[model samples]
Target: MNNKTAIVTGASAGIGKATAIYLHKQGYKVFAGARRIDHMQDLVQQGIEAHALDVTSPESNQAFVDFVLANSNSIDVIVNSAGFSMQGALEDVAPKDAKSQFDVNVFGLMNITQLVLPTMRAQHSGKIVNISSIGGQMYSPLAGWHYASKHALEAVSDTLRMEVKRFGIDVIIIEPSGTKTEWAGIAMKTLLEQTPKDSAYRDIVEAYADGSFDGFSDTPEQIGELIYKAINAPKPKTRYQPSFSAKMMVIAARKLSYKAFDRRLFKQFRAMISK
Candidate 1:
């Protein structure tokens, strides 16, 4: 029997929930957490341990780590999938809102990882799977803060990878593009609410909202499978792009000149909002 334990944050829905379930199926004891404890009853019913976790709170993070360790002796994997996008024009977003974004996306992840490291380091093996977005590599208008947070995550993850490698912990990043989840709707709603009615960015925000994500998105289950594949590898790559388009976009962002990439990206953004 495959006996491993995995911790998945943001397990109330979307990628985190899917990953928790997938890991369970693969014979790992899954401990899933999110603020929405009610939303995770389904996970509980399926034999995954679900707990209430406020990632932003250090107390909550410590408690979560304690609970998981109480149940399982070792934490073999930790998938940090608890993040949300704060979308709006940079000028329109309040500093507090931007800080909140960083709190959840960057600080929370870091905090949780810190709590788990002692256990992993003692065991001499563990996997840290961070669910980053292609936005970490590329950018769009009106999503400055969101992109910034992801960019920060990318840098932190890179540094952490080096820091933990000596201890036998693998830090892996999953950069998915659009996914079939409530995230898009929530992001759009936040964008509209954050932008003032008479704001100059209204047209762009509205148009961006109208654009459909059907063909461009992957299902949460697909990304979950990718995560499974990545962590299971004896020597996993530092980064995994779950979709072809996401890989291509990351390549473009890395290879193209700044101006060229910006122009190309803006053209696509214009097309998206124009439609």
Candidate 2:
């Protein structure tokens, strides 16, 4: 087993947890950070170090990095997987809620990324993987805040990639289409909570939570495997679309004209709410 160490954020459950366990199984020393330390008992039993980390807090993020450096001496890979979806109409979403979404999905991600950059750049050989989503590229009915955060993430990852390439650190973006995780359910709950019943967007929000849309949803384990693959690659690609049909969607979204895409999206949402 190799001694190379990797840190995974959002490690208590879902994609982060899955990726940490998989990397550990494959011979890397793994350190996982999440808010819920109680949920990481299994990782601890398997020799993976798990720590409590509130990604929004700089102190918490710094401490997690310090702990990893103290134990492993070097960090070879970092998978930024801590995130959530905050779905709402642009006009309907509260300002505080909108700020909170960016706090977790965009700014919080950068908080941890900043902590690891000095280590990676100093090593002159490391990998940084950012978990983006299909929302980064495409737009939908009522998920304005969630999509905007991901879009910002995409820009941030792209900029980081260009800035860090000189240091031999590879920056990669993983965009998953529909993955079976708490993300969707949490987004649905947010929609129900924020959008008022009398709001014009209410019908569409209800349709979203009802799962009226159909698409491929990969398992968390599946996405985990992809992240592991990215870490192991000697020369990883700039971006990877891993979910079933995700690449197709990304390509289609890019190719379609603005009006064309809007027509299709409007039709889909209208159909969903009509039922």
Candidate 3:
């Protein structure tokens, strides 16, 4: 036993899976969670214990924490990487889906965090890293609800960081720009399937689906490395944006006025849709 046990949600694939692998290599006992049991066979083969979890369910959250506790006394770290993003025009998005997005990305994250608090508090040391997107800080057309969930997560992380400081527990947020993952494809497909086909915004939606969207070279393993760094830091920062493009976007968002940022983004999308 490494004596350090970490739980990583969203471990089925992408960033979450990568983080689990990286953390295990770093010598921590890794416990991974996701809704897709079949998808986590790779994690299990790597020797990381995999649990079926739904972040939105309180019962599921409790069971996950309990299982970890039964096997280990200390809960050293947890990365709330489970998330969802359904892209569509705001007016066309189903209200239930919008709420569901936040339920998983925001409130569901809180559910696990709250469940782990007592254990972490008892230990007087723990780290909670939230996987947020750069989209939280910057917005794009046809992705309003996705952005809103991330924005809500950022606010929650900020407030939790302050509250948990005295408990010797650290809260960190990871803001990724673009990564080589299926997330974009999934989001793009959702946009097309869920949005009204006749909506005038179909042009940009198809533009996204056809892959004219601005893409990046960032990979899930890179995000894993960043999360590993944040976990190991003696004093971790509240926010870590690992990708250079992510850093630039964050800087621009901070430096430019909202109107300026909107104009720049609008021009880019306009050109793409027109093409």
Model 2 Cα displacement at 9 (Å)?
Answer: 0.4
The sequence of per-residue lDDT tens digits that candidate 1 reaches over residues 73-186 is 899999999996778888899999999989999999999999999999999999999999988988878889989999999999999999999999999999999898888888
lDDT of each: 0.92, 0.87, 0.90
Q: Candidate 2 residues 37-106, lDDT tens each?
A: 9999999999999999988898999999999998987889999999876677888888888888789888
Q: Estimate each model's TM-score.
A: 0.97, 0.96, 0.97
Model 2 clash pairs are none
Give the runs in model 3 whose Cα sits over 4 Å from its true position: 212-214
* Better candidate number, 1 or 2, judged by lDDT: 1
Ranking by lDDT: 1, 3, 2
Q: What clash pairs does model 1 have?
A: none
lDDT of 1: 0.92
Q: Lowest lDDT 10-mer window, candidate 2?
A: 211-220
